[model samples]
Target chain A: MSARRIVALSGGVGGAKLADGLMRVLPQDTLTVVVNTGDDFRHLGLHISPDIDTVLYTLCGLANPETGWGRRNETWQFMQALASLGGETWFRLGDADLAMHIERTRRLDSGQKLSSIVADCAHRLGIRAEVLPMTDAPVRTRVDTTEGRLDFQDYFVRRQCAPVVSGLRYDGAARAEPVHSAVAAIRSAAAILICPSNPYLSIAPMLAVPGLRQALRDAEAPVIAVSPLINGAAVKGPTAKIMAELGLPVCAPEIARHYGDLIDGFVLDERDAALADQIDIPVCLADTLMKDIDDRERVARASLAFAERLRAEMIA
Target chain B: MSARRIVALSGGVGGAKLADGLMRVLPQDTLTVVVNTGDDFRHLGLHISPDIDTVLYTLCGLANPETGWGRRNETWQFMQALASLGGETWFRLGDADLAMHIERTRRLDSGQKLSSIVADCAHRLGIRAEVLPMTDAPVRTRVDTTEGRLDFQDYFVRRQCAPVVSGLRYDGAARAEPVHSAVAAIRSAAAILICPSNPYLSIAPMLAVPGLRQALRDAEAPVIAVSPLINGAAVKGPTAKIMAELGLPVCAPEIARHYGDLIDGFVLDERDAALADQIDIPVCLADTLMKDIDDRERVARASLAFAERLRAEMIA
Candidate 1:
């Protein structure tokens, strides 16, 4: 098969690292990344897709290495001024990073399609990767926490994810139709890879989009999921705590099972290699700790090699 | 009168300089500046009041000297990306500057009044001088030109003011009422000083507001207009070129005629002192060249000193 096309699913930081790895291995235009829009929120009247921006900025070499999100060398003068002005500034908006949100919000207001604007933003940032939103429709990941149902930002930023999430719901998911690029990527894929992101908060929202999950399930391509949970903890964010809260084991097999029939194969970190046999799906063990650019590239190569092996088995 | 309250009418850039001077020289709460809003435009879905911000930044000690607009220490990454995105970025948005506009737009979208927002902005910037918009209504300065009518920004920035001005019109002024602060400033003022800004583009728009000119004409305050024209050239901007284009002499007395019965006095540059004797109103001559901070203070002091003389004449 002529250099196989691959589609990857992602959220923000953790997902972006794997996505970056995939980009390093895959040929230009060979990879299509479908990012979760569940974390998307309007802040200061600007439409901000945190995950999408993280992926885009990481791919474009603009992301801050220390934070693993937002642009490098970002200034907080605006936020400082906003705070001084008694404006709501819970979600920190870096000066350089804010321009993207502002332009996106502006274009969205001017009747442009979200996908087109995303494409425009990617092109402006000089990113070559195909970054697609899960859907054009707005889907908010609402957390029904102990503090009451709060918006994703309120739960994540305002409360510092301190609120115990009793349950999570992707608002507006029922009507969300997958974007044409997303569907096209899946249908024509050589393989589909799920990046190590929060399954409930990130991956679920994309799957919840009408017909998206079914498209992946029915595709001839092998579907591989990179476990976000390593050993007994989440590499980042609240995935492990959230899993425990929802009465699930904080292990690789548990995360693999979370995908159910949607995943044909799984990649677990070396730390969780011992538990790989417990999962029904074919599993590969590799170092998934993408701590730096080199680590990202190494993990990406392993994921690509794993996908290749799975695809060969599917052909056999 | 208790130390003579001073009200200054202003727009962006050139107006901000005098406003800065007034802020330095005038006692706290002694000056009320009614800034023009015709140059205000919505960019990236944010309501940007250029003149208001100019006055605010200048008064707060933040105006960039090199550009004569925007904040000091501003970064242009946002504008660079904005241009790359194929967005209409003729009006440059510096990264730091974008934050203020974004937050202001957000607050305005939340149904907050522009007056209150400006007040909050001034207070946050630690500016004691009152900065008020000429009117809260959406009024744009449209240039009726040989190249066809264009918005103020289009005429000024996009076209680089290359278009031959046939006439200038305030598109929404007939329906716009002066904001309460502007009216209150005019009514209770001990003296009203019009900054040496472009007459047709800046000051006329303020005057165009339905009853604003009438309010100034009837105010008990001695209204003084500083001539933007000096030595057959404008102190700043296209005042002289536009004046000549409109079939009027590029002279100080012509500015006096433009204001007509609205003023009790006029201030001219030393170069135009000879023509002051021929004007209908009482006139004063001073350097009126605000080249730096000290110059700004000098011009401000001179204007106030002139106001004092006008006040003394009225009292006598």
Candidate 2:
């Protein structure tokens, strides 16, 4: 098969896994991951981009396999010290992981844009693929929980996701301009794949950026989304809980409907084959449970094939 | 003796030891240490007050006994990670010590004054003595070396004090305002004791601040200084090297001479008693090596008694 430029829209952990799969199956320098920066927040006075770091570590094979987040063999001395100092320690930042936040904060303070810093970090860490923040400007996700309005990190880390999330908003998304490089990547991609991340939490924030979805619509390629659930349950995080809290059924069809016409195809796990027929969009079933590198590559290949089939059908 | 408020001027390590000694010997809340901020530089975009921290750690009994710097049992994971990320790692910031820098930087960024932050930290850490930065404003020490002019930390840490010191200047001393509490502490002090810190590098920066020496002169209390040298050599750091580079002899007499008109008396180590009678104002000898806790308390008592002697003579 000929090498093609693939663009992946993703969030943290779960999404990073599929992005890793794409990196493994795809050729070098042919992948571009536009990660959601809505989860980016200031922690301990340092700029922390959770999803960007997740994807960077995943693609570079530096992520902890067990946690599926942060760096492997990480130390927690910094967090311990912070706790001892009576500082906020709910969001545990590992010592090695702190380097990312410190460097990012320093550069950001010095007027460097997030995209440039990410690019430089990627290059320095020997990441072959391009990993971009969705927007350089602040676009923090504010979770409207049953307890009241809280920042994304407050709801997720500090509250331990106990607060029932009713609604979410990307605070600065309306005014935030999409990254030029991300838009260019989408415009020229052979196919754009949305990873198995929470539809409302991750993917929607990216689409909320004005002209971002328009870039997808204007692109001369098929756009596909992978269902985040396996057997009607999310592998990790509050995806399932958030869905139930919003009074929506936790199923593949609902995720497909959430994406709607923006996607040309939707890929579900093999266990959810029955639900695939219920989705109005063109649907494909594959093994979406990416437990290992080989499993990820397999799912990535199947998803790409499904995208190619949709493109062929449109041409016919 | 009745409890009397005492003001102490200090720098780092060596000064911190004597400050700790003062804390041990004096009544609670009787001591206020005005630490030099000239060595404070923005490293990795964090506001780090080294001398201020040393004072805080020492008074609170949190300092590493061997290094006489930073918190006890500190971990270097952050420094290791920073180095791996290609960050400037010449000045090693331990994981526990990083909390101080991060918190300080955050508060400073939010427009909180350094003196207020130090006071709060000292209170939190259970330090009975007050710890104050020399000034609220930036008063950086710049060393004019044979190699060229360099920032304090750049010369002290990165260059390992190898540069031949030609001169020293406090960059913002003239424009920097003295902390109101420190000035008040000096004016109302029962006695003022200058710790065994480098004359040019440490204590000089404090004196360089306009009206600081005036406050000492205006006070009715006597002022005394402890020599950093034991015999003819400094206990640690570049005190001897800088003294030699500046064409000054490294001896207790030179240090006493440096404090000439400012000090009412001078305190030299018992080992340097042989060289003390070279036409000095008033001199006292005590154990100044400070190898252990008892040594610290002993020196503190002797220095305070010397201040009392000077006060008695002035009254007579």
Candidate 3:
């Protein structure tokens, strides 16, 4: 068989780690990453694409290793000065990370699409894999909480995700057209992998875009998803809390049910191997916790291998 | 006599220094500084008012002592990152100083007037003296050079003022109205001291505003100007070079002539005392070199005293 081309739908941090691993394992230019833009917002008059930046930084080897967000060795001089001026300091913007926002804001204001800007930035950063935003149009993730609707950043950064999320809404998703590159990549893909990110907060936003879910459902490739939850808890972020708040079981089977028939195979953590039989789809048990680059590559390999098994079963 | 209320029209750097001096010597709420906004431009999607920021930083004791502009303890991480991303780095925005630009741009985008924003910033910075922009309206300074017309920052910062300035234009000044605070300050002023800023590049922009020049002319206060030139040289910036390029004599008399009938008195450097006979206005010779806070206060005191002398002459 010819080399497989893989398209991965990702959010920030966790997703970025796996995307990086996939880039390492896949042939150059064979892996395409479609990042969630639902966390994008305007802060301090600059367009801030949190998830896109995280993915780009992670792929370009500039992401902070400690936090898995922002640039490594980032300085807080911008935030310090901003605070001195009595400006908003809640959503921290590092000095190095601010460049992306300022430049993106300038280009966006000058009428350039976000996808084109991201492509140019990725090219400049020397990333071989194609990194595409889910959509060029604005798609903000609003979290409905007990305190009412809070912007994604407000809910995540400002409030520290304290409010119990009642429901989630992708503000502009219905009207936003999926970026042409993403659709094209999906259409030609040999396998589609959904990275282990917050399923409701990250993947759901991309799925909310009118035709994107349908596109995934219609893709010829075997679709596989890595569970964000290992046992009954998310490794990071508000995924588990949001899941419990939404009255859903916080487990691998639930994650599979979340994707339903869209995913042909699901990768579950070895720790949660016992729960594999409960999942309706074809499942692979592996050490899904990506603690470092090695683990990331291992998980990525297992995911691709699982997709290959599913494709073989379909052919048989 | 009642305590004098002074109003100063200033540009950047040199003008800001003297304004700081005046603020130190003058009683609370007795001094109002009207800053030139002609150098204001939208850079990287942020409104950058060079002169106004300098004045604000200077007056609030936040300006860099070495640079005479921007904030002290500034970090260049933002610029470094910006350069890496192929963003514009010619007009350097320091990490600490960027807060001013971002905040100002945010407020401006929200339809707030420039004057109100300046006032709020000054208040937040703990500045007691009133700081006002010359006009609330947009009035960009465009330099007509040997290389053709260029925007103020393009000529001043990007080109390092290397272009031979043939002439200057305040693009929107003709239709711009002076800010109400500035007009009010000038109308009721005991003296209007013109700071030692570039006559052509700085003060000329303010004068270009339709009614501003007329208002200065009709003010009951004696209009006194401090010469930016001494011994045929500018203390800083391209003032002397611009003067020579425009074929004007590089001396205090030429500075006085530039101001023409608007001034009743002129403050010249002690080194230029011999040239006093050539000036039409009453001239006060002092050490105009403001190397420190003491020098700034001394020069400020001399300017005010000279204005008082001119007021006495007017009464006689």
Per residue, candidate 1 scores C-alpha lDDT tens digits across A1-316 of 3566789999999999888888877787688889999999888788999999999988888888887678888777777766766778778878767777877887888898888888878877767678889888999999998779999989888887898889999999988899988888899998888999989889999988876887898889889999888788887899988888888887889888889988989999999888988899899899999888889888888877888889898899
Q: Evaluated with TM-score, which candidate comes out highest?
A: 3
Q: Which segments of model 2 are wrong by more than 4 Å? A: A66-68, B65-68
lDDT of 3 by residue, B80-199 (tens): 988888999988899888888998888888999999999989988888789999999999999999999999999998998999999999999999999988898899999999999998
* C-alpha lDDT score of every prediction, in listed order: 0.85, 0.88, 0.90
Better of 1 and 3 by lDDT: 3
Better of 2 and 3 by lDDT: 3
Candidate 2 has which clashing residue pairs, if any?
none
Q: Which 10-residue window of candidate 2 chain B scores lowest in summed lDDT? A: B77-86
Candidate 3 residues lying further than 4 Å off, grouped into runs, are none
Best by DockQ: 3
Cα error, candidate 3, residue A199 (Å): 0.9
What C-alpha RMSD does candidate 3 show over the true interface residues after superposing them? 0.9
**Per-residue C-alpha lDDT of model 2 across residues B1-316, encoded as one tens digit per residue:** 3588888999998898889999988999999999999999998899888889988888888898777678888877777766666777888888878888998888888899999989988888889998999899999999999899999999988898998999999999988889999999888888999999998999999999987878987888999999899878988888988888889888889988988888999998889878978736899988899888888888889999999989989999
Best by lDDT: 3
Tell how far residue A47 is off in model 2, in angstroms: 0.9
Chain A vs native chain A, TM-score per candidate: 0.97, 0.98, 0.98
